[model samples]
Target: MAYVITSSCIGKKVGECAQVCPVDCIQEGEEMFFIDPDVCIDCGACEAVCPEAAIYPEEEVPEDEKRFIQLNRDFFHRD
Candidate 1:
């Protein structure tokens, strides 16, 4: 995964990120938005516009907030 939407977005998903995403890889969820890792092209446009500052590149994700990486994956891949 490249960018992960963290807890900061839990209740503040404004959808601007989705609009800016060239690939339309960001999906709205009950709790937050999940970026489809496979669909995302890593363009970083969404990250630049997120008002909540909830998006982070995988390598730059804070250590404690890393769980969102899996959260994003499971959002689309859950059984």
Candidate 2:
């Protein structure tokens, strides 16, 4: 599964994860950063580098943070 960027990243456009992503799948959001599921290589680099711990695997997304999965998907779908 792909990694998803959660709400905790809102207003915290930290770019550490983006800096480490090899596929360049991470995209800037209105507040946080979103990982394009289609482009992510499932490398887990984003999750390892995120300062806010806002990145998580699609299947491991918590109940409260589940919206991020769709949010990440929609961000790219709309493109």
lDDT of 1 at 12: 86
Residues 14-53 of candidate 2: C-alpha lDDT, one tens digit per residue: 9999999999999897888899999999999889989899
Tens digit of per-residue lDDT, candidate 1, span 1-79: 5789999999888999999999888999997899988888888999999999999998899999999999898888988
**Model 1 Cα shift for residue 54 (angstroms):** 0.4
* lDDT value, residue 56 of candidate 2: 92
Clashes of each: 0, 0
Q: Per the 3 Å backbone cut-off, how many clashing residue pairs does candidate 2 have?
A: 0
Return the lDDT, model 2, position 3: 92
Weakest 10 consecutive residues, lDDT, candidate 1? 1-10
Candidate 1 runs further than 4 Å off? none
